[model samples]
Target: MDDLDLRLIKLTQDGIELVPEPFKKIARELNISEEEVINRINTLIEHGIVRRFGASIGHRALGILFNAMCVWNVPDHRVEEVGAIMAGFDEVSHCYERLRSPDWEYNLYAMVHARTREECERIAHEISLATGISDYTILFSEKEFKKTGVRI
Candidate 1:
């Protein structure tokens, strides 16, 4: 990545504009062509400098008010298998395995989003049934304080 590419990364760290021609707008700012802008981004993605280029949806704005993290106390031997099963759910936005602590026995974590708490619980139940790991807990969020794009 050259200076222009670095500048592009800096400009896009937050997110691209919600415009009909966001690349065009970026091109104007950088004094480059729109196609160049897209090519630079594509190059970054192809080289794995940028893992993903996508939108960060506001689920609450879309009537998905209930959000919770479902933590499962999955066995060490089954962490990857169980995590993948939970991650496969459409209701789950993100799921992964983490290091467990002495006080906290849960290792698998999944972020579940729904319109209501009952729906969230329903998804959790389905995950439990699918994984056959019943030792789990669901902690609902009272509010969404922060939702922002990642910095490069």
Candidate 2:
């Protein structure tokens, strides 16, 4: 709600360092007390500016070599049910419902990961079967251009 709160949100958008007393380090750099930084973050969340704060681990470091964006043509009536089922899977890291496209009419989107390409395909097939949606597509990432957090 104040300038300090805005600065805290901006700095935190870049992701926090995974170190002991990370907030203390941030406070030192901002010339504020650690408690102030923590309180401000809480306030920001209460204001709906911060959806959630957490760490994102690199999938490669966990031996997850395969990742793909799986899109599904879920019926409008069943979108929520299908999305919840897809998101509940451990392989799915992210899931969302978007507007249907011309080339691809899928509204349900999910990110899947596995150890190999075949594994990824199998998971996609399973999702299709589970959702009872035969029409789907998998767009695998050839290379990662950027994965860093955004700064607002």
Candidate 3:
């Protein structure tokens, strides 16, 4: 990848257009062929530079009424096991493991979505039972501050 490839990745991060010839717009801006733009994106993913290509939807638009961030105190040896279980749930939109601080204990984090706060809590309770990690925290969003792409 070169400077142009980096720029392409940054530009595409804003989310691709929902049109037929999306790459054509990008190619025009980059002064390259549409085929080249598509090829480079594929190469980026092949080399693991690009994790995956997809839209970042507004959950509200899709009738997702509630969202919560769940943090769990999973044992070190069972992090992957518990994380995978959480990730398997359809209610979970995002799940990962993060470094813990001295005061902070929960390491496994997941984003749970539902049509209501009660539903979100129900899913959280089920996850607690499945993972056997009752010590967890759930933080819900009051409002969305920003939603956009990162230029990396």
Candidate 4:
């Protein structure tokens, strides 16, 4: 990655403009051709510097209001297996394995989103049934804060 690559990433950290020629706009700002702008981004991705280049949806704006943090007490021996199983669900947007504390017994966590609380519960139930891990808890979010991705 060169200075131009850094500038390109910084310019797009928020998002590309919703225009027919978003890359063209970016290229104009960076004083480069549109093709060079695209090629640079592609090369960054190919080299693994940029893991993903995609859109971030506003789920709440789309009526996906209910969000639940479903935590599971997965066994140490089966953490990876259970995590993968939970992550496989379409309802789950994020899944992770965290270190458990003395007070907190849950190790696996999954973020499930839905249009309703009942749907979120249903998804959690389906995950429980699929994983055969009944010991779990679902915590719903009362409000959402500003969500942003990492900046360059």
Q: Pick the winner on lDDT between candidates 1 and 3.
A: 1
Clashing pairs in 2: none
Clashing pairs in 1: none
By lDDT, rank the candidates, best first.
4, 1, 3, 2
Query: Largest TM-score belongs to which candidate?
Result: 4
CA lDDT, every model vs. true structure: 0.90, 0.86, 0.89, 0.93
The runs of at least 3 residues in candidate 2 whose Cα sits more than 4 Å from the true structure, single-residue gaps closed, are 15-21, 28-31
* Candidate 1 lDDT, 45-99, residue by residue in tens: 9999998788767787899999899999998998888888888999999898888
Query: Model 1: residues >4 Å from true position, as ranges?
Result: 18-20
My TM-score estimates for the predictions, one after another, are 0.87, 0.83, 0.87, 0.89
Model 2, TM vs. native: 0.83
Error of 1 at 105 (Å): 1.4
For model 4, what is the error of residue 66's alpha carbon versus the real structure, in angstroms, after optimal superposition? Answer: 0.8
Per-residue lDDT over 30-127 for candidate 3, one digit per residue giving the tens place of the 0 to 100 score: 99999999899999999988887776678898899788998899999999899999999999989999999999988999999998998989999999
Q: In model 4, state the lDDT of residue 33.
A: 95
| lDDT string, candidate 4, 35-105, tens digits | 99999999999999998899879898999999999999988999989999988999999999999999999
Return the lDDT, model 1, position 151.
Answer: 69
